[model samples]
Structure formats: C-alpha cells, structure tokens
Target: MNSKRSTEILVGLFVAAGIAALFVLAMKVSNLGDFTDDKGYEVVANFQNIGGLKPRSPVTMAGVRVGRVTGISLDPDTYDARVTINIYRQYDNIPVDTSASIFTAGLLGEQYISLSPGADDFYLEDGDVIDLTQPAVVLEQVIGQFLYSTAEGD
Candidate 1:
C-alpha cells in the first residue's frame, strides 16, 4: 500500500509540472507573458503586397517598436491587402503624411511593417489611409538585377 501511494504522488507531480510548462509555453507564443503594459489603438494601412507578414509582427517607427499587427484583409474595390495594426496610445503622434513600408527582418527572417513618419503637423485619424506605401522588396528581383548589372559590367 505504501508503494502504491508513492507511485500515485509521483504521477500527480509529473502531471502538475507538465501543466505549468504548457501554460508558460502558451504565454510565450501569444506574447502575453509580460506584466508591464500600455493600451493601444487600432489603425489600418493598405498595401499592394504584404508578403509573409504574420499577425503579431512588430510595427516599427524609425527603428523602434511602436506596436504590432492585429489583422490583415483584402479590399473589394482595390484588391490591395489591408493591414490592421494597434499603436500604443502613448505613441499616437504620427503625422498625416506618414507612409508604411514592408520590410524583412533579414535575408531569410520574418517580415514586418515599418512606418516612416512624415513632417506634417496634422496627425492621422483612426481609419486614415497611408497612401505613400512601399511593398515588400522582392529578393529574386534584386538578385536578378545584380546578375544583370554584373554581366553588363563584364
């Protein structure tokens, strides 16, 4: 009877540990593990191409993380990709002429939306569109251009 009780306790402890590990893993995956926080506001920017941009991807402004992408969709009239992002309320001083550009983290890393702020005194509203946008740079096109230029030079 003592052996049986010991085995039961071991199993229970193992199960509890697994549950705790799973919870930690989930929090990390969803980026909800952090304690200190600030509220943000949702805003949308349309793009001609939002190549491989995933939800929760960082939205950067002048090399700083201002927010993250909340959602993405398609426009019925323009067929462009509409990317929705949430900017922290404290960082909501973007000018009206600001533009968005799709950028990759590295040569083979993940992609993110980079916002380039303009000098306009007027700020963009919640639903305002970033008209001056640049799509993701095609790597293949860049390589081809490089090869073509080298051959011409030779």
Candidate 2:
C-alpha cells in the first residue's frame, strides 16, 4: 500500500509538470511571454489603408524583428490609419528617414510592418513620426486588378 501511494503521488506530480509546460508553450507561441522590462520608444506612422494590421503585430527591419506595433487608431482629421510602434532600445540606430511598409510573411500569413532604412544623418527618437510609409497591399485588390487586366487584354 505504501509503494502504491508513492507511485500515485509521482504520477500526479508528472501530470502537473506537464500542464505547466504546456501553459508556458502556449504563452510563448502567442507572444504573451514578451513581457520584458524594457518599455522601448514609440514612433508613429500614418497609412492610407492598414488592411489587417493589429496591435502587437511585429515590426521588422531587414527581415529581423526590431519592435512591435503598440496601438492602431484612425485619425479623425487626416482620415488615415495611425499606427504606433515601440522599437526596442537596442535598435536605436534606425534612421529618421526610414520607410515603413506593411508586408505579409507568407502568402496568407499575418501582416507586419517592415522598415527600410534610408540615408539620413539623424536617428529616430521617441514621439517622432515616420513620414515615408506604404500601406498594406490587399490580396483581393491585386487579384482583381490582374483579372481586369487579363480581360482587357483579351
């Protein structure tokens, strides 16, 4: 009886450990584990259309993730989509004239902001605005245009 009870306790511990491991994996996969101490710096960019960009979307530079989109809102006066991004402090050398473009990782993957560095003397600072911006290219629009052009040619 004593041996059986010890085995049961070991099994319970194993089950609890497995559950904890699964919870950690889920949080990491969903990016919820990025609760670091660094608050980073915020920069704003306006786009005419932001298709499916969401807060917490990745902000990448040269294919490497450098930050995350913190907020997205509509500008009432300009009627444009205002996107706020928090660049990690380690990537503070981004040029002021860098261009921000929305891009998809795979054919139908999530949208993220891609930064293209430019030749500029100054570096981007907190509360600065990135003026050179490109909006997301909707797949539907591209397909429609292609079909229209094909029919027009025929």
- In order of appearance, the predictions have TM-scores of 0.73, 0.80
Query: What is the per-residue lDDT of model 2 for residues 1-154, given as tens digits with 9 covering 90 to 100?
Result: 9999999999999999999999878786756666554778999999999989999999999899999999999999999999999998889999999999999989989999999999999999999999999999999999999999999999
lDDT of each: 0.86, 0.94
Checking candidate 2 for backbone clashes, the offending pairs are: none
Best by TM-score: 2
Candidate 1: stretches off by over 4 Å? 1-30, 33-39, 147-154
**For all candidates, what are the clash counts?**
0, 0
Q: What is the lDDT of residue 37 in candidate 1?
A: 73
How far out, in Å, is residue 65 in model 2? 0.7
On lDDT, the candidate that comes out on top is 2
Candidate 1 all-Cα RMSD: 4.1
